[model samples]
Target: MHVGILYSRIRRDEKLLLNELRDRGHEVEKIDVRKQQFGLDRMTTDVSELDLVIDRCLATSRSLYATEFLDSYGVTVINNPRTADICADKAKNSLALAEAGVPTPNTKVAFTTDAALEAIEEFGYPCVLKPVVGSWGRLMAKIDSRNAAEAILEHKATLGHYEHKVFYVQEFVDKPGRDIRVLATDGEPVAAMTRSSEHWLTNAAKGGKTAAFELDETALDLVETASDAVGDGLLGIDLMEVGGAGSGEYTVHEVNHTVEFKALNDSTDVDVPARVVDWLETKAAESDAAEAPIA
Candidate 1:
């Protein structure tokens, strides 16, 4: 099968996938979004013969626009534009999960600093202030006091970007020194890991130690529900144990669309890239069969 990887830079995660696809004798096209021009009617890069296009662009804006353009050109794109649209924004991500009855962290969004402060007070101190669109725990604040909240809000208000002004305040879950990251495909678990750190943010990218985690029945159900809520594809569903590590209860905090799994591969025995490639092959075959001429 022919696969086109839409990306700006190929990281270790992308390398793993490329190696797996190549080893399996699948034709791979590395389409650099930075180097390509996407036209309304067509793109400078020809994707007509590709069986599938995977959006691996590091920038969320690039991922969304590229997939949307590719989709408009009649090419099959994994984690389709609709899914990308919902997952790229934290506000949309939370709404989708909540509307689907998935237990997520209590979140509030406000347009101005004053309104945001009201929300922060509502959730009380030690809540979190996050950028509406970001990953790897960058620009997230754990507001511990009124002073800290005022300072952060002032900073964000003056930052000038609309996204910064749109404050995303969430109730901080007192997770027991760790959080779970489950990689799933179409609501099914591919592998699970726990990211543990003394610090508040426990993302692997934020220097959290990782270990393989076995999903309990409740976790399995939440993972599936959260995946479906975000329009499942290859996703990283992040959940925090409500009370402690062994607690059966959980609150999902985020679902990532362009999910990076190199850390997951290292933390678990699962052949992460191989499993992802297996899913890709099935999707591509189904697309081909669906598009074939009728007898």
Candidate 2:
């Protein structure tokens, strides 16, 4: 099978998948988005011949556009453009979960600082303010008081970008010093891990400690629901404990597309890359079958 990896920079997560694909004798094409030019009528690479293209672009904007271009050229890409479109923004991620009846943290979006202030006040102190398009916990503020809320709102209102003005506020769930990251494919769990930290932000990118986690039935159910809500690709379904610490109840906060799993591979015995490739091979076969000439 021929696979094209779409990336700007190849991180460890991408390296692992690349090595696995090579070791299995699959032909891999490295398509660097930076070096390529794309247009409505043309693109740099012969994407039509590739069995699949896995999007690994670090920037959300690049990932969305690159996949969109490939899809327009009739190439198959994992975590399709439609899924990327929905998962790329925090507001859309939250709405998908809620609309699917998945238990997510209470969230609200406001266009102006005054409206945001009203939302923050309604949720009371210690809620979260997050950028609409971001990851790894960057620019996420825990607005702990009226004074802090006013300051943050003022700062965001002054930023020139429209996204900065689009305030995303959520009721902070008091997680018990940890949260869970489950890497799933099409609503099925590949492996799970708990990211623990003393600080409020427990993302692995924020120095969170990780270890393998055993998911209960309820957690599994939410994982499946969240995956379907986001249209189910290679997803990172994030959950926090509800009903108190270690109480078994869970609230899913977000679902990630282009999910990084190097930490997950390190902390668990699961052959993460191999499992992901197994899924890729299945996807490739499906694409081939769908496009095959009729007898």
Candidate 3:
């Protein structure tokens, strides 16, 4: 099968996938979004021969636009534009989860500093303030006091971007110094890991220690539900324990569309890239079958 990897840069995660796909003798095309131009009816890069295109652009804006354009050109892109649209924004992510009845952190969004301040006050101290569109725990604050909230809101208000003005506040989950990151393909678990750190933000990118985690039935259920809520594809479903690690209760915090899994591959014995490739093959075959000419 012919596969196109849409990316701006070849990070370690992308490298793993590329190596895996090549090892399997699949024809792979690396389409760099930075150098490509997307016209209304077509794109500078020809994707007509590709069986599937994986959206791996690091930048959310680039990922959304590029996938949308590819989709409009009648090319099959994983995590289709609709899924990308919902997962790219924090507000949309939260709403999708809540609307699907998935237990997520109680989140509030405000467009102005005053209204945002009110949201912070409502959630109280020690809540979280996050950028509307970001990953790897960047631009996230654990507001421990009213003064800190005021200052952070002030800083955000002064920023020129409209996203900064759109404050995303959530009730902090006292997750026993760790959170779970489950890599799922179409609502199915590939592998699971725990990111533990002394700091509030335990993202692997933030220096969090990692270990393989065994998911209980409850966690398995939430992973599937959260994946479906945001339109399943290859996803990273983040869940925080409501009680403790062994506690069955969990609240999914986010579902990532362009999920990175090099850290997950290192933390678990599972051949992460191989499993992802397996899923990719299945999706590509399904697409081909759907497009086959009728007898």
Cα lDDT, model 3, residue 274: 99
lDDT of 1 by residue, 65-90 (tens): 99999999989998899999999999
- Model 3: colliding residue pairs: none
The 10-residue segment with the lowest total lDDT in model 2: 40-49
Q: What are the lDDT figures for the candidates, one per model?
A: 0.94, 0.94, 0.94
After the best TM-score superposition of candidate 2, give how far the Cα of residue 132 lies from its true spot, in angstroms.
Answer: 0.6
Residue 126 of model 2: what lDDT?
A: 89
lDDT of 2 by residue, 163-188 (tens): 99999999989999999999999999
Model 2 stretches astray by more than 4 angstroms:
none
User: Candidate 3, which segments miss by more than 4 Å at Cα?
Assistant: none
Alpha-carbon deviation at 162 in model 3, angstroms: 0.9
